[model samples]
Target: MNRDRSLRYRLAGIEIFAILLALLFLAPFYFVLVNSLKTLGEILVDAASLPEAYKFTNYSRVWDMIRFPTALRNSIVITAISVAGIVTISSMTAYRLVRRPTRFNNLLFLAFISSMIIPFQSVMLQLVRVTSILELRGDLLGIVVCYLGFGLALSVFLFHGFIKGVPLEIEEAAVMDGCSPYGVFWRIVFPLLKPIAVTVVILNTLWIWNDYLLPVLIIGSNKDLTTIPLAVTRFFGQYTKQWDLALAGLAMSVTPIVVLFLLLQKHIVEGIASGSVKG
Candidate 1:
């Protein structure tokens, strides 16, 4: 009876701790949401407290200033195209690497893995220069290409791990059934990648959607191609920051991705866990 009571107590303590930890992570969200409804002065005076009166006008003003629709369209298009390219290229590449396992393929796989360790900061200058030379800078294609390049290594790594778990016999069976190599991959192998593909999409979407630095570098001075992150920066100037509008823009920026994450979050854990175990 005493042991049972002790175990119960321990479990309860763990639950309490988990709840507190979750709230700690959620605290920033609370502040962003609550203060977004307040005026700049109200935020300066008491950001921690709820506004005396919610000023939803902050969102309206932010929407117009940031050109929310254009920003949203840019972010959506870039994220979608980039993620699709990443998935298609990475999955095929991973499939080939796993099935072939030639010396060159092994070396290539190692190269891909190694590139992940190289910091993005280290290559930014060279990337900018190269993009300028290629006339890729300040274009949607430029940013999307950059995303594909940077996103490939990690996506390939994930796909590689997951592909290992897929039975070779399945591919062999498809081949024997007269399925073309392309058909075998697209019809057979690719479908099985749905879980990890969802993981890849969700991860990259969040990264690309919220990314500012890459867009700043590649889409420089192109107001037409401005993403939400770049658009929101208009609220913060060198001398003064519009805290209310900034927070409102942030709230708007995060909503779509947050909804996406909430819907597909289970796939992330499931895919990663499965990949690790299968690998």
Candidate 2:
């Protein structure tokens, strides 16, 4: 009886601790949301306190100042196209590597894995130079192509691990049923990859959506191609920080991605578990 009581107490304590930890992590979001409704002076004077007057105009002003609609459209186009390319190319590459463990394929897989370790910072100069030389700089295609190249290694690695767990007999059965290789892969293998694919989409979407640096470099001086992150920078200049407007812009920018993550969050764990077990 005493041991049972002790275990119950321990579990209750753990739950309480978890709640506090969650609140700690959520504190930044609290500040952002709260300050977003305040005036710049109010935010500066008492950032943690509630607004005396909720200046909702901050959002409207930020929206107009940043040309939010244009930025939103640019972000959507780039993220969607880049993620689609990443998913298609990575899955196909991973499938081929798993199906054919030839020396060349193995070497190629290693090369992809190795590339993942190279930091984007290290290649920034080269990236800018190469894109410029190819006349890809400042074009929509430029940023999309860069995203595809950088995103491929990690996506392929994830897909590779998950695909290994798939049974070879399934592919064989499809082949015997007179399915072409393409049909076997697309109809049979690809469908089974839904969990990992969703995971890939979510991860890459978050990365590409929030990304600022890549767009700055590749889409330089192109106001039409400005993304959310880039647009938000208007609130911060050399010395001044428009906290109210900046926070409002951040709140607006984060809402869609947050909704997306919450909706699909369950799949993240499922995909990782499935991949680890299968690999």
Candidate 3:
């Protein structure tokens, strides 16, 4: 009876601790939402306090200034194209490596995996130079290709582990039925990879969409190609900042991703759990 009481007490403590942790994380978001409704003067005076008079016009003004619709369209196009390329190409490459398993293939896999550990900052200058030389600067297609190069390693790594768990008999049967190599992959292997594919798409979509640095470096000064993050940054100046407009712009930038996550959160959790188990 004493031991049972002790365990119950411990569990209660843990629950309380988790609740506090959740509140800690959520406080910033609460602040942002509440303050976004306030005027610039209120925000500057006491950001933590509730607004005396809510000025929802901030959002409307920010929408116009940031060209919010165009930014959303650009982000959607780049994210979709990049996610598609990463999943398709990485899956095929991982499938080949897992199925073949030759010494050369193993070495190449190691090389790709090794590249993931190299920080992008280390190669940023060189990457910029190379992209410029290739005339890939300031284009959505170029941004997609850039995402492909940086994102491929992790995608390949995830697909490689998952592909190993897939049964070889499926491929063998497809081949025996006179399906060519490509047909075997496209018909048999690709279908089974859906879970991991969804996982990759969600993960990469979040990263590429929210990403600021890469777009700033590559797509900066190209007004037509400005991403939401870059556009939001424009609201801040060296001498003075547009606090109200900036907050409104930030809210707009974050809303889509938050909505997307809420909708697909189940898949995201399932995918991560499955990948961890399989990998």
Candidate scoring better on lDDT of 1 and 3: 1
For all candidates, the clash counts are 0, 0, 0
TM of each candidate vs. truth: 0.90, 0.91, 0.91
- lDDT per residue, candidate 3, 1-279, as tens digits? 999999999999999999999999999888888878888788889989988877789899888888899899999988999999999999999999998899999999999989988987998889899999999989887889999999998899999988999998988888899999999999999999888899888878888998988998888869898888888777664314667777777888899999988998999888777766754
lDDT of 1 by residue, 67-93 (tens): 999999998999999999999999999
Question: What is the lDDT of every predicted structure here?
Answer: 0.88, 0.88, 0.87
Report the error of model 3 at residue 53, Å: 3.3
What's the true lDDT of residue 237 in model 2?
Answer: 59
Query: Candidate 2, overall lDDT?
Result: 0.88
Q: Sorted on lDDT, highest at the top, how do the candidates line up?
A: 2, 1, 3
Between candidates 2 and 3, the one scoring higher on lDDT is: 2
Residue clash pairs of candidate 2:
none
Output the worst ten-in-a-row residue range by lDDT, candidate 2: 233-242
TM-score, structure 1 vs. true: 0.90
**Candidate 3 local Cα displacement, residue 70, angstroms:** 1.4
